[model samples]
Target: MPKNRYRNKEVKFFVTGHEMEMIDKKAAIAELDRSKYLRKMALEGYIIKQDFSQVEQLVYEVNKIGNNINQVARRANEVEYVSLDDIKYLKKQLEGIYGQIEKFYDGG
Candidate 1:
């Protein structure tokens, strides 16, 4: 045990062969060690696994938009002129992204 460890108590229990197999499978599914899995299940009765695919997609979209905005900025610098319609379109795109972020936070 590490000196900085806070868990000082030891727990012992017995399980049938079948029960042990089930526990191992469940622990593997949760991607946790048996000790942590058992402790969490015993204390919290359940575990929540969060999925971030939507967040990943959001980041991808934001990056693409950022790239587009940078291209527009580069063009404006080269020409010394920026179209108002282009600015409006970029603003609309940004607003749509913000709406998605709001929806994510609001659990919509």
Candidate 2:
């Protein structure tokens, strides 16, 4: 709250209940009063960002798992599976690991 910034105009907008709850949680984690945090973000274009180093690590681990699967499958264009059940099981396991890399990749 800087007085030199000039007068503060109040503005209101509709938000979903879930969004409101998330705002409250974020403000609590930052130890900021809800209104103050909201106002600061609104006026300053500031946002709270999550630390994604752990997420990057998770992505790395998942990618290793996918590579291991590919290697075990002989790195072929087609997968060799004797049974539908086995393919289904493998797909389920890999689904959880998919897109995790994209989440943490900054596209550098």
Candidate 1: list runs displaced more than 4 Å: 1-45
Worst 10 residues of 2 by lDDT: 75-84
Off-target runs (Cα >4 Å) in candidate 2 are 1-8, 45-107
lDDT at residue 86 of model 1 (Cα atoms) = 82
**Which candidate number would show the highest TM-score if scored against the true structure?**
1
Inter-residue clash pairs, candidate 1: none
lDDT of 1 by residue, 1-108 (tens): 567779877789999999999999999999999999999999989668988887997898799899989989998999988899989989998998999899889986
Q: Model 2, residue 60: what's the lDDT? A: 79
lDDT for each residue of candidate 2 in 1-108, tens digit (9 for 90 to 100): 576666566578988999999999989998999888888778776667878776777867777777766665773446544456656766776775655555546542
State each model's CA lDDT, in order: 0.91, 0.71
Error of 2 at 102 (Å): 13
